[model samples]
Target chain A: MGLAERRRILELQQTILPERERELADICGRAIPYAVDWDTFADDAEALSLLEYSACHRVAMALRVVCRDALGREAVREGLREVAIANVADTSAMALTFEGGVLRLRGAWGQRSAGMFGDAEIGALLSARL
Target chain B: MRILLIALLASTAWYGASRMRGASATRRALRELGHVAVPRRLADREPEERDGLALFAFGRVPGSPQYMGSTTPYAERLVVAAWTPTTRAEAADRALRTVALGVEGLTWEADAGGDAVAVGTGTYEANMARRPAWVLVRDDSARGLTFAYMAWRRDASREAALRTLERVAGSFAPALPTAEYLALARARGGVR
Candidate 1:
């Protein structure tokens, strides 16, 4: 694909990440009133809060993906290493970390991070040998 | 109302596309994925808590199962859709196809974790037709599960939801490690 096409694809990919957050937001929003009123349901608030935090972490990663230039692949890969300092959950047990621009999981996010900014399962399902 | 209508139209497209994407996601249990979730992994955890509960994960929340391109960007890896979101209305099927995949569907949910607020969920319906979908399913069973779980609000219902999850996931267990996992598995044993 040409640079223009790549950019468009990347843009579309970025566009979709937000929808996940929105859907989760929508799902949680439905129960706030009941949660606040019910003493035992207080856990509801915490669950939503944690989900929000987790969503933010993903948003940050997506931002970094959008920022990278295709030619500077190595730099982008290094950029991912720095992400370890971010609030990302440890992904070390899931996969291999390769030297090229892509962050192949030696130990990935392990939860569901198939991609740095996407699903981790495809990498597994497709045997996406990074 | 006009925008809602348009949005509804868009949602229907998405649903149709998702259903058409996978060739075989019926009530079949995937033997390939058995490696991902070890019998040991299930065994190690306490059965009481783990029972009647399971996790739904895909490379992307709504990613097409079609193995497009030799190598898709890492961002399109897997989706962790906790529940199968689906619809009966033709409009919903259309909407499902229009919306793209979301990657972080799984991160926020843990059975016993967190502070959460159940915000309102919007539906693309005209009162008579509705679907509570986050991701469109490839088959009827997945759609049915999503419909039921989306309606739950109480503890008993949530427990039921959990059981439903286990049943649905039981149909797709041994979550295979993606190629990504395969490499990681090989490297770990490689000389340090």
Candidate 2:
């Protein structure tokens, strides 16, 4: 996916959907749960494209696969490692490694203000994925 | 010649005694701030208070240079700072700007629980020298405070520097009781 297209998808996932969910809750006079389906982008290429735009979400999904599907762990790790290697030349780019069921980032992607996802959003995304 | 030698000896003694005093003062101040298992070789300078933050700096002896100079070959330094009335994110940003200055290609990670954040980077000094540095920030939400620990070492592997930082972080204990600190903040009208 192109950068613009990926950004549009992220806008829908991050802003539009949440706003719509909030509107529904307001109309119903109670809280409503909205879940994002990671399987929608099941293809590795498409998922990797989204990973560039929304890393923490993709990482959370990848981590969920690592935790629940023992058979898929190696594949997920390989995919993430590929991503890490591809971005090795970008000094400011975020890098990550998964070992012993722990996820580690190579840089302060979370502290950056450049459309990076936050921890709360990661938790919500993970919950939806699992 | 005899008088000159005696003067030189006296000056050396004074310098050694001052360094010892500074290390002891640093340790006392660190104890007051919180519980940290300071390494025996990590001699410290006196704690400095500036703009509501307490800065405690330490460096290894025998080869460590004085106060983070650029000339030391096998130098190592650790700094522990506490910033109050700030969130973890704010503290992390501030530490990056202040403590991690001149570092390049920094990588950061926050724990799965979101309570701790860490940044690792390398510093380039004179003669194209590179050293590893790690900063770990932990939040105490009850007191609206965040503690940042930074460790850097020249001629040391990244793994070793990170291990030193993690060791200090693992052994730290907060000095103030949560309830007591909260009560004091309330009494002072600092917290609602």
Find the 10 residues in a row with the least total lDDT in model 2 chain A. Answer: A80-89
TM-score, cand. 2 vs. native = 0.36
Task: Tell me the native contact fraction for each prediction.
Answer: 0.00, 0.00
**All models, DockQ values?**
0.02, 0.01
Give candidate 1 regions above 4 Å deviation. Answer: A1-64, A67-69, A84-130, B1-91, B95-166, B169-192
lDDT of 2 by residue, B83-173 (tens): 5553335444564454554455667664545454554555534233355556555554554444454444433444655555556655665
TM-score of each: 0.20, 0.36
Tens digit of per-residue lDDT, candidate 1, span B117-139: 11222232222333332322222
Q: Pick out the ten consecutive residues of candidate 2 chain B with the lowest summed lDDT.
A: B23-32
- Candidate 2 — which pairs collide? A106-B107, A107-B107, A107-B108, A108-B108
User: Model 2 off-target regions past 4 Å?
Assistant: A1-130, B1-31, B61-74, B87-94, B107-113, B126-128, B132-159, B177-192
Against the hidden true structure, what lDDT does model 2 obtain? 0.43
